[model samples]
Target: MSHHMTKNHPDSPNGQDDISKNDSGNPTIHEIIDIRLSRRGLLKGGAGMVAGGFMSMGLSACVSDSSKTATTAKGFSLGFTAVAKSLNDVLSVPTGYTASILYRTGDPINGATPAYVNDGTDTAASFDFRAGDHHDGMAYFGMASGGSGMDLNNSSRGIVCMNHENINQQFLHTAAEAGVGFSTAARVAAQIDKEVNAHGVSVIEISKAGGTFSVNTASTYNRRLTAASDMDIYGPARGDTLMVTSYSNAGQKTRGTLNNCAMGITPWGTYLTCEENWAGYFKRPASGGLSAKMATAQNRYIGSSSSNGSYGWANPTGGDTSGTGLYDRWNINLTGADATADYRYAANTFGWVVEIDPFAPASIPRKRTALGRFGHEGAMPAPAVAGKPVVFYMGDDSRGEYIYKYVSTANWSSADVGGGLAAGNKYLDDGKFYVAKFNSDGSGSWVELNIANPTISGYATYAFANQADVLINCRLAADAVGATPMDRPEWTGVNPSTGDIYITLTNNSDRGKTGTTTGGKSRGLDAANPRYYSDLKGAATQTGNVNGHIIRIRESAKDHSATTFQWDIYLFGAEAGADATNINVSSLTADNDFSSPDGLWFSRAVPGLMWLQTDDGAYTDVTNCMMLAALPGTMGDGAATTITNTAVPANGNANQTVATIAGKKATTDTLRRFLVGPKGCEITGITETPDGQTIFVNIQHPGENTALADVASNTTASFESHWPDGGNARPRSATVVITKNGGGLIGS
Candidate 1:
């Protein structure tokens, strides 16, 4: 049975001292979007079913008193509603705060001639060095004064590194509008170049003066590492025959990072950007056909034959068979005389963490092969402990995937702080990667993936040739090691003050209720993935952890190197009212209700301050996705609460409870929803000023619901969310800064 609830647990100060407090003594402000009696609460109070699966809880309240109690007790007072909206428009913040478009899709880099026009149609050559689309994970690293590491605390100027996740094909094509001409090779090449430029991270120097920040566009540090950029593969996996290609004489280094998602920064001052959902970029020839082994591998990476090629790179005229090497490289189907003749390693190059030095413009980004490749969501480093090995946590984003950690071979040292890439070479180039196996009895282990210790070679389940092979095909190795499967792990954040790690398991529709026979691959409700419920929008309906959960993992020794950890469900996500037995894992009230927890972060300024962002399809009926802030108690603060699976009746009652919070119900005293977004937008990626006075947050993909044809007009207004515009206007994902009128630490 799952350890659903904790019973009278002790409150140990494991990672507590690490939590930051607001030094400026300013009160925080909170605004509640909706308040009502929940349908589940009504059902438990004796209500019957209603039509459309939305059991209405009478509008009897407005924000829970529990939320106010939690906030006041912590000395924080929520602030004004700076950018409320119904129509799709860019978000804006309160006065004294300002925001500018630092970079956007098709923004030119590399000192190119005829700068980007901001239109969709940019040439391939111009795009080879331009900014990519869909900015996701990012980091800000302060540069040392005099170009040396001695002035580490100085923040005069810093490198701003941001990830370009993916492209919007519907927005990219002019022909799709005319519906006459087809996408050609040149068009595909241009798209590929733009996408490549966008995939990896862009490092640009940003400086602040007079309370405003601007990018030093011409700074020598400005560089875009894209899909076509040359990147060296390091670690035991480097130079493996599987990584060989006609382009690489050494059979190791390869081109580009793709689908770069969330990121991590090392203690040594290097950036770690991860690749996710990279499998759809290529196509295999149908007639020639891939060999059995090759097909299996290809299918494992990408999907089945029915999956359409992204960017139309497969069509001959679209560049799949052009005389230029560009078009030919996308064909992963066995085409040439041998592996060396074609780009068999094309898929192999992506899905690994690419490390770059923000200070070194001339240095090439290295794809660290030691961190076993998968659908890498993000890599988060534990606080550097002196004389101890540095630990990095990661998650595979696919459903039923695994959580992973990599421990550096060398121990931490104060000297490594400013070492940059050289420090990465020492710590990250070689390391031990382990996968987590969470037990139901409130304990977990980090199963090592070392080939020697794992005896992977002798394992009968799957064949492993060497360490390189093990790292290259990490999922198989993880399965062999019996790693616990998770529910679509996404971004991860660590409480800088407390060592607790927070992971977002976005959502899994195919879980629990779906009777797919893929045993270990298809999962049901367990302690870790307790919720199993469905939600409704206007017409769309979704189920199975429809709302997600935030899981906090605490190392047993209060150190990241420890093999054992204690974990607890920090929050359960749902609408104001839903099935209490399934959706309300932590007994959350209306003030803190949410769904599909995605972008999660803890404040660098305030140790206990946690920000939760939602990327949801389940609760669109009430509002769009949103962001919430919480002052969470540590892992051992609450008693374990039992969670029952109402949707999947036969799952047989898995138990879960708040282990440490004695005499406390899952109420607003613990969590509160802070901000909600406009229609069809995911509120994500938040940062604060060094003094904690100013806050910067991103509102991504506004007007995402507007059709391609409706691009000419302000379609977002019809949907009732003209956010930054406040009226009928187009919506663009933009960052906004928030600062108190009195200029003090935020959320104090």
Candidate 2:
């Protein structure tokens, strides 16, 4: 989610409030000694290359001049000069590469649809045939030559399935803000319809030719799944009473997905779009008291709120003539006779990993509830080993939330490569769910989140009725099991060679901050979230670990089903010139410094190569958000260390010394900045072609800082940045295709 969307809201300027109360004496990770240590042998050895399943497709003769930076051919190495930190209104890349727009908001999906005007004049009905807004997580599924079925190895033609996380409200309406054009008492029905339609997932066809990629607007597989589309609820939570709503009285279905952030790609050629920040879309009035069970779930997920959702989507009237209350379903209040008579249970149907078949555009999406929903960032699956259960790693994106994983009951089979959602039913529907518990000694264990677990079975705060209840109210179950509360765990990525899981803790301002308590426990300093410092933002000062860090873990015996693992803080994010003793723990230089790591992905074709993306608000004064290329080491590569955290002025706290495990510090060889995005945008959602020569990245919410009042004036000065489609055009969220000038592995 974009922090710029809620910059003026009551919550922190960082998009979410820390809502988890996991104060069980857990430890946070910290670094010490301000060291600049590098193992030159490791970079030359090229270890983990073949192990990561990469074939030596030697560089093409057409390789660009930038590839001359490759010092050795042993393992995967970054081959381009790091792009300098930039504040320009355009995307910047290395000298020998190009970043061109691929698909953009309101781009026509089919030949019948007209080109987007982008003047806040597009009708609501047209959005179903056009591209949605705010593109987030995405996956590219290769299609057969005839555009009929899956072709996992096809590099030239494929289907790009992406998430439209949300809308730039000011640009979507004719009069900028919602209440400007229509009634002051309620939102305009047409504007609300257009906004809702613009939020969901998009499946479009794309082709590559002459070293350039473009959307295939006339392809048959192109389609849009909006907020009004039908979806089937699957897994243990299906048909549960808590899921009943006016739209689905049987509780076996729900309307559509919302706030889709990160993503995952299945071996069977399907897309897993995660639902993050969905709780903030429902309307729950404080005047209407909730049932004890309902109240516990609502408060735990969304916190206590007396107002409508972020956009007040339910404030509009007279749009539900079919008696299903299409506009009214956004409200979660208990009205009318019972659950079936109203949308009180609508919130329970969201917060899941929805499975969609990009190859089969006519199929209905399935909400896989077996994943145990709680602000799902992404559901990244480990490599599917034969005769072993398929394992998927997940992270809850809210502050103080827990990390989760699911192991399937059935063994993996290569024959199911084209199984589509049928493969999902066999693997994702019935699984054993778990939450991670990190220990102070660099070791960790997974706590099974089953209804039969003693801690969950006998909980006193809110009794879980059954397995379904436990899945719906997963945060409560994790709380009961004493899962480790992390620093805003956002994305989980599995190493292609090592079977290790890497998670991004995108900064938690509440970590170790005084006077901030939950469940009678204060969020103090610990090993897993060690830093507690302050940074000045204009006139205001922000505290806590504002720069964030990434942690990695390896399953015991390289088994995804293993309940035990080893973990370490892989890298710390800080400014290049910050205090090296406490803040710049990673020993970063100007070439590779970054803050707020959000989207992370491992290249399938390049083996050990990994890509990192940022959604930052803390470092905007220096540069826009960016993406980086890195070759990481294994767990426990660095020694344990201790650091002292000085208290922020005016914040009530004292200096505290904490010891934590630190991985090998980043170096110019192991990490380097690759691309810097446009102004007021986040660099998220990355995917590469089968050959690893071409890659796609999403730029979300460009020019988002534009004032609503200036939107209707229609001038170039009204926007913070005019990018992708330059000149005086309104800014749009879009996907850019990056490639070496000629033909060579990207970053090679």
Provide the TM-score for each candidate, comma-separated: 0.82, 0.92
Q: 89-197, model 1: which lDDT tens digit per residue?
A: 3232322222334555555555544555544556656655666656677777776656633243444567768777665443444433324332433344555554455
Candidate 1 lowest-lDDT run of ten: 6-15
Local accuracy of candidate 2 as per-residue lDDT tens digits, 371-447: 99788899999998889999999999876788999999999998888899999999999999999988777788999
Every candidate's lDDT: 0.61, 0.79
Instruction: Tell me the lDDT of model 1 at 584.
Output: 59
Candidate 1 backbone overlaps, count: 47
Top TM-score hit: 2
Q: CA lDDT of 618 in candidate 2?
A: 81
